[model samples]
Target chain A: MSTLRTEEMTLNMGPQHPSTHGVLRFIVRADGEVMREAIPDVGYLHRSIEKIAEKVGYHGFMPYTDRVDYVCAMFTNQGWGMASEKLANIQVPKRGEYCRAIATEFNRLASHLLSVGTMGMDIGAMTPFTHAIREREMINDLIEELCGARLTFNYMRIGGVAWDLPPGWREKALAYLDHFEPILDEYNALISYNKIYIERLANVGIISADEAVNYNLVGPNLRGSGIKWDIRKDLPYSVYSEFDFDVPVGKGEWGKLGDAMDRYMVRIRELKESVKILRQALKQIPAGPVLAKVPRNFKPPAGECQIRVESARGDMGWYAVSDGTGYPWRVHVRTGSFAAMGIIQKLSQGLMIADLVTLIASLDVIAPEIDR
Target chain B: MEAARIYQRIKDRFGEHVLEISDHQPDPFIVIDPASIEEVGSFMRSDPELALDCLSNESGVDYKDRIEVVYHLFSYSKRHGAVLKVKLPRENPTVATLENIWKSANWMEREIFDLLGVIFEGHSDLRRILMPEDWPGFPLRKDFVEPTEYHGISTVRESPIIRLDPKKK
Candidate 1:
């Protein structure tokens, strides 16, 4: 008699799994509860964005950027606008810079809220996720009032914002900030201290500073591994340097483990710093022309340039090569999510199958950002 | 370190391999030869003064005569950036891979390969990333000709064609 040996069972985790978020699929070869190999299959949400940029004019391409990283739409808008401004040699007005700073910081808060909150849900803690998203909805309401849409708001224009702050916008935003702090405290108390959550994330995905640098990881992922690098502080493009805020590095924050838990804590600290930036921006903003005086049909000279901005995810870069025309010859978005996904392939190699979702959530891999 | 200082160091280090160093409005770029890319790249990454630890981006631009491969490297420790360019002949465009230095270069090189058809000499899995497996010529190249006939479907050509009729006018 001969016994048949079976290979590891292959399972598909999603092109539509709720935890996988945004059209992402994982081909997992597992033995019982242990994952042997996890192959990430992308391109489901591919919009051929680079090719599309070749067709659209400079300013017309702004709207498409909002869809690239929907969670942090303002950063996407700011990155594209900054690249265009650099190419055209146009200066943004003081008022426009202040407004862009505020909008981008607000979007940062929203992106981190979803990242940390959904992270809790993935780790089997349900209440914190509900509480965190409830706060995010309030911010979404403000974004909707600013732009017509709740999500994918094409609000940032090339030279400035689409429009100035509406009536009572600052007061309402301040009220939301005041309301959000206590809830964040509650989240820290609820999930950050939970033993089960701590065990799963404490040292699970520990990427050292050397490995993080080698992989070119950015944002909280890099910081979490004890690298004191934040694009906002290191290479400030807009009015970020003028503001007073801490670039939270996660070396000794939570135990000695620079792992997934450290990344989660760094995000929480960044949220507080973002709030501080918003407060200073709201106080010192001078009233003047919100839009810069740019030509109706703007055309930059034939040249190639690259601009990098610190988004909520990480270093969001836009490389535009112009051909002395209204449209760009080529545009490439170096998205942070796409960079972070590279690390996951290495980190998930030895982990259990159950821990995979938690690891994915911790990385905050937005699929459109990856697919685009 | 400032952009000017880095430009000077790059010029001093790789004398002739450095094609042109310019302090443009946005950033500074050093254009170099495609053959010595790996040596120059290793120096940029490991040199204590120019610690470009992070490979920010890798992309390809297709000019009419040649294909240009661009590498954007940023040093977080020193808070400086430099763009490195390498040009290759369009006929058989090839460059050494930097995957051994920075792991993230893996995907970006694949992207360049898929779009511009530039072959990386030592890439582990050099395949089309964004495009389909059995796709035609690279779409981003200037000389890329769209298929006029594929799978028995003939696309209508815009050029005028001479006709011979049974009854001449």
Candidate 2:
């Protein structure tokens, strides 16, 4: 036998690849099946959304916020609305806050379903995706009835929500939640505990709790790393304080504590928590006006404020500065996906090339969310 | 810890570096000298009482007169947060990188660099995170003028309403 020489090769994974979930690219350095590093080359979907906020007045920016993270648009809407409300010191009516919470929790369910479903699909299980999407489509229909649009539901406003819950909508939402609760077990049976899926994700791309917090991971991602911090629970934002729900953290049942499977399981567990929140919100929602009264030209005092919302992906931070003008002086959205993407190159070291998809899906890094 | 108490601690530690504290109605912030940001960041992160472990949000604003970089520091252990700002001259806004103290600042500084043209000295990987590498100017800057065209591709599209004007036809 003769000795052979080899060199690492470079490969481009996306920019338009099926497993990426959105327009994301990865410059992968590979030696055979294992990767040396997978550097994320993002911003393919950059839409200058933050700049647009400076041009459009505060109220006009609500619709645009929905596009920030279409998978869980309600949180983005709530984040922007909360930021503006904080800047102006406008109090959202109790009913309106309930509406916001109800709509956002439903959005979280839809988002987690898509995430878990896509994780299965990314790992080569196709049937579970159809099942998850089937449940998600129903949520879409319910949200569409609450707000005209489904994906980009601009259901929130600076003071409160755009409208009150539609006629008999609470009963319909409750019915949907009732039907959706049992489906979690079905999903688990189908995919979550599948032998091959566990083999693929277990003990892969483990991020310690300290690393998660140091990287500024939020929402489910932080929980996945065994950090029991949820913006809704610990920070106590909006009606989240009023609603009773459990915050689920990953236990590493089948793998290392902070591995991909742990992240996947955290999202699955959160789907249940979201259902619980929705149940409480729908049952306990008080009767009153949803939209608060405000002047046509809405401009807050010259001040800076930031609002944190527990979006499906993670903790979404919206920092706004108003120079006492019709339009905001500056608006910046520090999204979870952007922070998640930052850690990919570090995590991708020494992983199988195929497992890169697993890493990205586990983090649930949506493109628009990263770019915005 | 309360923001005012945190300010007092920082002031006691770094007297000259702490420029001013605006005890505003909501979200009071401490303005620190750009030169001492890294020192303050490390102090805020390591000090047990002020264990601001997570850099929750970092953003840059073009105030026309000056460029301000805002850091929203949060502590998961203590469950409290503080806002810090560094005002740099508009012409060449530069600040020391906080990436060493808080890993989250790596990408955030790059974003500030990309969008606002603020330089983060000693950043390990300082490149455009959102905009293209060769984009003309920082789009987030207040006085930035969008290029009429990029790479010979027209940035502007003719409005259909303008094209459909009967008077022009």
Candidate 3:
């Protein structure tokens, strides 16, 4: 059978498009509407933070970690803090562990709410986005009470946390948790189960478990593909072993095991687990020093270390090489969003233009994390 | 499969090809010759017991005399990790690509090539992932200096000179 030859149309999705997240551009080769290939163009936000690690001493680099991934800055803060601690062999106190865990869980809650709500908005629903933002504001307030800033919290310290909980902050955080647990249900009713939402997300942007693992997908994306991998539960860190929590993986509730809906559902289920972890941390936290007393000229022995953190995105790895000096010899941050970038061109091969947006939203690839 | 065991297994399998195995400060690692990286990666990916299916992170470090490439590999099934390192001469830092073994290494290798200037021998598309393709010199190297300007845009920031504001002074 003879067929007509057609040229693929070139479409640019922006270093400025609202949907591509931040500064991420995709040049898609499309045959009419279906994308033949969508090669991603990243690095718009690269500030050379790793190079800065050489100039700035260990402590001076804390705030920069927040910029590495601001959506869930607390985790990156903790990641860097812990990496430094590992390098120096500093032991964080019991109270410090509880504070780090509690703050981290709250940050996780805020990050997931934004991810879910924004995905909803990206899929044509707007109300859920507002609802998600409303709940997130409460978290912002709670975090601000603990640390001064709201969005970029350089809260975690090298040995401990930057600040101790303010007077009555615990009571307020517990109240917010009580209020927040019920909001997850409201989120489900308002947008999670909507017919249009399900149809738009379900069975789209499928990533097989093997592909997920092979791609080095971290956090929920790998778990969403039914691979039971989580640094928090698997390779326990920061008193996480003491707490009881469930690791949620995609069971293909609406479609195949690793579809857009599966990844979305994984984040939704994570909200419940985060709340559970928060409640336990709040109850178990004991009174002690918040900041560990590290020396002024802190120099870790010459060595190389790789610290993995379960941030909002998949595995966030901080690799640091110290040469028995105050400054790190070399610092490299390998983020989940960076790994996820490899899959976009593969996933976008046969998807419609609209489906591509859904895939981007479902993957939850943030710009700064990938470009850092 | 602890890191020590994994190192031992790799040492046993590859004998003289293994350069040095050490349990340094925090983690255990095995330094291997750069030429056998692809083959080692293949066995690591296909082996059931030591199924290192995930290439967590690949980093290139620059010392004065030599360049070091570090590969952090993890096995989901076995719940184990191994750090594979290769030391290359500073003149021509080239290591065989493991992109075929772990698809994730595709962009990661490119990034190292872009920022650190380590050449990945068989990377499918080894181009700049972070910096512009034509960007001058690898910025991560210790000896690299910041350019004064780029495309007429000033790259240096004015030093914060002690100045008295007319109103404050």
Q: Write the per-residue lDDT of candidate 1 for residues B1-169, one digit (tens) a residue.
A: 8777887887798898888887666666778888888998889899999999989988888878878888899887787788888989999999999998888898888878888899999999788766666779887776677677766778556768777897997
Q: Looking at model 3, give its docking quality level.
A: high
Please estimate how well model 2 matches the true structure, expressed as its whole-model Cα lDDT.
0.92
For each predicted model, how many residue pairs clash, with residues at least 3 apart or on different chains? 0, 0, 2
Q: Residue A28 in candidate 2 has what lDDT? A: 98
| Runs in model 2 lying further than 4 Å from the true structure | A1-3, B162-169
Off by over 4 Å in 3: A1-5, B160-162, B165-169
Q: Taking the tens digit of each residue's C-alpha lDDT, what string does model 1 give over A1-372?
A: 368776788899998988987888888988888888787777788776777788788888989998899999999999899898899888898888999998888889899999999998887788888888988888889888877777888888888888998889999988888888887888888888888888778776778888888887889988888888887887777888889888887774445546888888899999999999999998889899878887869899888889988899998888999888888888889898888877777887878888889788878889999878
lDDT of all predictions: 0.85, 0.92, 0.91
Candidate 1 chain B has its poorest 10 consecutive residues by lDDT at B150-159
Clashing pairs in 3: A218-A314, A219-A314
**Isolated chain A TM-score, each model:** 0.96, 0.99, 0.98
**lDDT of residue A308 for candidate 3:** 91
CA displacement after TM-score superposition, residue B13 of candidate 2 (Å): 0.6
lDDT of 3 by residue, A1-372 (tens): 468687879999989998888899999999988999999999999999999889899999999999999999999999999899999999998899899999999999999999998998887888899999999999999999899899999998899998888999888988988898888998899888988889999999899999998898988899999988889999999989998999999999899889999999999999999999998999889999988898878899999899999999978999999999999999999998999888999999989998998999999999999999
Calculate the i-RMS of every candidate, to one decimal place. Answer: 1.6, 0.7, 0.7
